[model samples]
Target: MFAGVDIGGTTTQVLLCTADLAVIDSTEVSTPAREGGQAMVRAALDALSVLRARVPSRLLGIGIGAAGVVDSRAGRILVASDSFRSWAGFEVTATVEKALGVPAFLDNDVNAFLRGEAAKGAVVDEPYVLGMTLGTGVGGALRLNGELLDGPHGAAGEVGHIPGFGDLPCTCGGRGHLETLASGRSIRARYGERTGRLLTARGVAEAAADGDPDALAVYEAAGAGVARAILITAGLLDITTVVVGGGVSRAWDLIQPPMLAELTAGPPVSGHPIRVVRARLGSGAVAIGAASRARTELDAVTRV
Candidate 1:
């Protein structure tokens, strides 16, 4: 058996699976992100303890998909959001391995998302695809020739931080980033600014479904931002397939029209016709991908 952990801003998930990738069980726990990386690791270990009690299987190793610019080779979080105070520079892999007395591997959550989709979910059998998640923040991953694109800076697929967007400030202390417009947080923020009412992104979607013009405009703007990002990705990489998921994408009905309209109007490039679709794995992609990563690491170590 192998274990996988997905550490998000609000919660962390633990999954147990067989060697062949069949999931046996899973658990969720609140992420102690504010207390720092060590606290967060303890929360994950607690979740793992619960899962172990349920399954009682011997785990081969553990893999983690975390929200940050992760240096997978060194198992370090190179950069992280303020939600996780003092998270950067933490040696996640070594810490987890030492705590559990088993090998541990770490990767950016978006990379794990793409790995799951490319290996078994949406875009399966397709070696080259773009993966985007529109949640609290916008995230992206690239799969080229059947491998996740982990750039030298461990930030290669971070399309959400790309500049040349509007002047809205981003959480990363940047201006004109795609995250300012395309993320679920941005959608809610834009709606609240226009209507003077604070609501969840889902509430904004419900209002859009009810044909509220202001809500519709917010979603349309989000769609347009996503379209712009997609076009930019296509222009640079010539990748035609984009698989989108996350909380915001649940409002596909409200976003697709404007997104398609913008895509239709964009200038023709090498990958002129882009195909944007939803992810098939739903909430389990990151865990499955993390498990796959653990298996890969185990195989590599065995070979060496």
Candidate 2:
């Protein structure tokens, strides 16, 4: 058996899986975001302890999928969002391994999400993919030739931080980033700016469904921004297949039309129409992917 953990800003999810990555048991707990990394890890560990007690199989290893710029090679979180106090520069895998007496591996949450989709979800067997998640913030990862590229700086596929979308400020303190227009938080903020009514992204989607013109326009702009980001990625990486997931993507009915229209307006130079699809694994992608990572690494070690 292997364990997979996804440590997010608001929640921490843990899963017990078989060697092939089939989930046997799972649980979730609130992440102590402001309490520091030790508290957050304790939350995940506590849930993991509950899951471990229900299974009789010997645990082989553990894998963690965490939000931030992770240094997977070092088994540490190199940089994290401000929401997580004392998260950056923490030795995640070492701490988990010491507490649980097992080998542990760590990866960027978005990288794990992409790996999960490639292994068994939306982009299964696809050779090339660009995975994006549109939640409170936006994240991206690249999978090429069946392998994920972390790049020299571990920030290779950070598409959301790319500039030139508009003059809107980004959470990263940059001006005119894709996240300013395409993230769930951005969608809500954009709608509020137009209507003076603060609503959740879901509420804005409901308003759009009810024929609210302002809400409709806000979604359209978001869709257009996403389309532009996809085009730029397609142009540079020549990767046309994309998988998008997260909270905002639930409004696919509202976002897809404008996104498709924008894509059609400016096709990539290679003349291949970008194929964008929604993620199939839903919220469990990261955990499953982390399990898969552990399984792969353990198998490789055995062979070596």
Candidate 3:
């Protein structure tokens, strides 16, 4: 059996599936932030230990999907949560392997999402795909052929930090980044700027769906910003499909038109229309992708 853990700030979900990626057991627990990554890691291991004790099978290893700039090549965290201090560049995979005595694999959450989509969801039919997550910030990853493209520093496909649009503040302490203008927080904050209403991203989407012109305009701006990213990425990577996931994608009607418009206005493709598609696996994508990574790594280790 193998384990997959997606450790988010709100809730942590774990899955103990078969060797073939079929889920055999699962559990989720509220994350405890007081202890930071240490506590969260312990919680995940505890869950896996409980499962190992229950199941009558050999435990292979664990896979982790983290929500930060994870450096998978080094199995370390380059940058973690903004709300907490820092565990910058800490070798997480080695630590987890040492603690559990099982091989472990770590990956950025959006990278995992891309892997999941490529395997079973949006990009199942394609040989290459891009996955973008639009929640707290606009996160992205790319998969080529069947492999996740982790850059030399394991920071590939971070389109959120790309520049070209109007200047806006980003969580990474930079201005003019893509996420600053197109992310969920930025959308709601922008709406608050115009209407003086402190609404959530969901509320803003609801207002847009209700035909509020201001809300619609907000979505238009977001779409334009996101389209800038797509245009730049297409020119750089030449991928045919872009799969958008996360909470903001729920407002696809609001964001897609402008995103598509900007993308289409750019230099034409070679008769292949650029596709901005929705992620079908949704929340499960991250965990499933992480598990797939675990399986791959385990197989590699066995071969070695």
Candidate 4:
């Protein structure tokens, strides 16, 4: 058996998987976001303990999909949001391995998401693909030739941070980034800007569904932003298969038309049009992807 943990801003999920990658048991717990990195690690460990108690199994190792800029080789956080106190520079993998007495592997959450999708979810069997998660923040990942592409800087597929959005402030303190217009937070902010109504992203989507022109316009802008992001990625890597998910994606009905419009507005690149689709794995993608990362690493060690 193997263990997988996905540590998010609000919750932490732990799952147990069979050798064949079947998730047999799972548990979730509220994340201790303000308590610092050590507390966050403890939360993951607690979730793992819960999973083990539910189903007795010998875990070969643990894999973690954590939010932040991760140095996967070091198995630690290189940079992170202020959401988690002292999260940056925390030695996650070493600590987890020491506490659990088992091997552990860590990766950026979005990278893990793509890994799971490529392994068994939406983009299964694809050789090259791009993935985005449009929730609290926009995240991106790339898979090249069936492998997760974490470049030397560990920021290979961060399309959300790419520039070209025209001077709007982004969550990362940057201006004119894609996240300014496409992230879930941005959608809510955009609606508030138009009507002075404070509503969640879901609420804005609901308003759009009810034919609110302002809400519809917000989603349309987001759709255009996503389309431009895809085109930029396609132009650089020539990988046009995109799998998107997260809370914001639930508003696909509102965004797809504009997104598709922008995608085809320009001539096809290399005679290949973009093919974008929704992620099928839902919230479980990160955990499953983390587990797959652990499995892949184990296989690599065995061969060595």
- Clashes in candidate 3: how many? 0
Better of 1 and 2 by lDDT: 2
Per-residue CA lDDT of candidate 3, range 18-77, in tens?
877777877788767456777777787787777778776887888888888888877778
Which residue pairs clash in candidate 3?
none
TM-score of each: 0.97, 0.98, 0.92, 0.98
Q: Write the per-residue lDDT of candidate 1 for residues 1-304, one digit (tens) a residue.
A: 9998899999898999998778899989999889999999999999899899999989899989999999999999999988889899999999999999999999999898887787678888877688999999999999887788999989988989999888999999999999998888998899999999998999999999999999999999999988899888888887868999888999999878999999998853873588888898888888888988999889988999
Candidate 2 segments whose C-alpha is farther than 4 A from its true place? none
Query: Which portions of model 4 miss their true places by more than 4 Å?
Result: none
Question: Which stretches of model 3 miss by more than 4 angstroms?
Answer: 50-56, 267-271
Best by lDDT: 2
Which of the two candidates, 1 or 4, achieves a greater TM-score against the reference? 4
Candidate 1: give the clashing pairs.
none
Superposition error at 12 for model 1 (Å): 0.4
CA lDDT, candidate 2, residue 148: 91
- Candidate 2 C-alpha lDDT tens digits along 178-212: 99988889999999999899999999999999999
After the best TM-score superposition of candidate 4, give how far the Cα of residue 139 lies from its true spot, in angstroms: 0.4
Give the CA lDDT, 0 to 100, for residue 69 in model 1.
98
Clashing pairs for predicted structure model 4, backbone only = none
How far out, in Å, is residue 116 in model 3? 1.3
